[model samples]
Target: MSSNLLEQLRKMTVVVADTGDIQAIAQFKPQDATTNPSLITAAAQMPEYQEIVDQTLLKAKSDLGAGASQEDILTRAFDRLAVAFGLKILEIIPGRVSTEVDARLSYDTEGTIKKAHELIAQYEAAGIAKERILIKIASTWEGIRAAEVLEKEGIHCNLTLLFGIHQAIACAEAGITLISPFVGRILDWYKKDTGRDSYPAAEDPGVLSVTKIYNYYKKFGYKTEVMGASFRNIGEITELAGCDLLTISPQLLTELQGSTTELPRKLDPAKATAMTIEKIAVDKASYDKMHASDRMASEKLDEGIKGFTKALETLEQLLAERLKKLEEKAAVGV
Candidate 1:
């Protein structure tokens, strides 16, 4: 009798905590939790998580041996940091934890593939089965190709930064495990492009975009699960009640926990199946053409990569400084 919107929503869709904050995951108790460079960087700065971050850095140094370069150590530490946080988060949530590959490798197919292998290896080494983890990669063409390879190897991938039907169709055709469509980011692009301040929830650009993608996937019977992510508000969440999954932020999770709204399911696969939606084939050439035309998708995808790359750079600098401090303190003891 006391269930809130979150409780009601969970009945129809899997809820994933879109955060790296372990405390938030523990509090929300979402089925899954996800992390990216930006989220992990924010979490690393928190005092409570200092021990975890330090341990990851120290372990990376120990594994790489004394002859490793600072850059090598930083790379190793950054990779380990993601799994370190994933391990901590998996301890609290019962479902999978998504860890992102380096954003800098978004356009490098081989680099992305290699990084994915290393990440899976690290997780497997930690005694965690690959089923409990999802390696997140950007939805660039190269990234998708890399995911296609990883999926065949029994390594699942969550394609992120997806904004257009072209990207969604490409991911689906590639047989990716899941795809993350950025609802809020799509809305952000539309608002800026049109110079509009608001949109009715039903007409919201992002909402409509995700609805279209969900319907298409169902109509065509693609198995790649759709997870609407990067939500700007609860309206977006409530509007996508029946999506396969919805990763929500702690702030919005708090709001949903506070209100006992009667949340209704808006996306029905049966209805989508009955609708007449034409399918689109997305190969490299068509993907390029469609991506070029959809200003929102192209711009947002590029911006998202740049933003995440900047965050990773900042995190590396943070680790380098922390490692320096550790070395200085150790020298003092000697």
Candidate 2:
């Protein structure tokens, strides 16, 4: 059999599975895995994960007491479910697992920090160390600040929903452990706004955005890792062959594993340093201005947050229905 693109990509970059499905993680055997509300919700519907959902619901009912409100039970259940999935993922991958905070808390720095601590606490309670987990937060200004605080406390963070250089720079400056600069979402915005059918990987705006962020990070000697995320195609993945990491979906992973095409290294720190790009600093005003000026970045950031929020709400609704059923079953027995 010929060599696969995924095996080739692994030679230079860390491959992270971007699904909450444990079976897919096992199939791909990625170095690390990341889970969000959407993924977790989707996986929860599968029969294989229902036991986890049921157990989490039972525990929430017991811990929250009979008088606890439905919202209280659901909030605790979701936390437990997220960590439960992370724990299962940890058993499969030797590397870290990223568990996200609620998207609704993206703009609240203190809320985000509190939630991060809560997640870490849950993982710790389950015998997982802080080093084995990455608290995924949205890359809003507040989220970056929350990550800064979390980093100081020895909690590593993966900043997501990043679309602009301002967000990347702020995240790097905050000493975040990693930043997931979305590639496909950027391309989606550009294609919609410009009415273009498609662009080659080299000129793809999403690819360019990630390459720029990767170069900037390397040029400045920042230790923050740039993880290219939200890939729409194998071309985008191959174009970013030498990124610090790439969190790819299972579908794309399958496509890559089947392809025998040569994957060349497209990003190098040495080459980036030799380039004539000027260094720019971003403060609050400049950060806001730069983010505001980029219509794609601003619109997509908001849209991404809202999309995740909707998925989270759906997950909550599912849990509420399950919890209601469990309560009813118990009542019948009583």
lDDT by residue (tens digit), candidate 1, 1-334: 7789999999999999999999999999999988899999999999999998888888889999999999999999999999999999988988899999999999999999999999989999989999999999999999999999999999999999999999999999999999999999999988898999988888889999999999999999999999999999999899999999999999999998888969888999999999998878778999999999998999999999999999999999999999998888888994
Per-model C-alpha RMSD: 1.0, 1.1
In angstroms, the error of model 2 at 227 is 0.4
Pairs with backbone N, CA or C atoms under 3 Å apart (clashes), candidate 1: none
* Per-residue lDDT of model 2, residues 1-334, tens digit only: 6688999999999999999999999999999999999999999999888889999999987998979988988889998999999999999999999999999999999999999999999999989999999999999999999999999999999999999999999999889999999999999998998999899999999999999999998988899999999999999999999999999999999999999988889998888888777788887888999999988889999999999999989999999898788778888995
Let me know the TM-score candidate 1 reaches against the reference structure.
Answer: 0.98
- How accurate locally, in lDDT, is each candidate? 0.94, 0.94
**lDDT, model 2, position 316:** 93
Whole-model lDDT, model 2:
0.94
**Candidate 1 weakest lDDT stretch, 10 residues:** 276-285
Off by over 4 Å in 2: none
Displacement of residue 82 (Cα, Å) in model 1 is 0.3
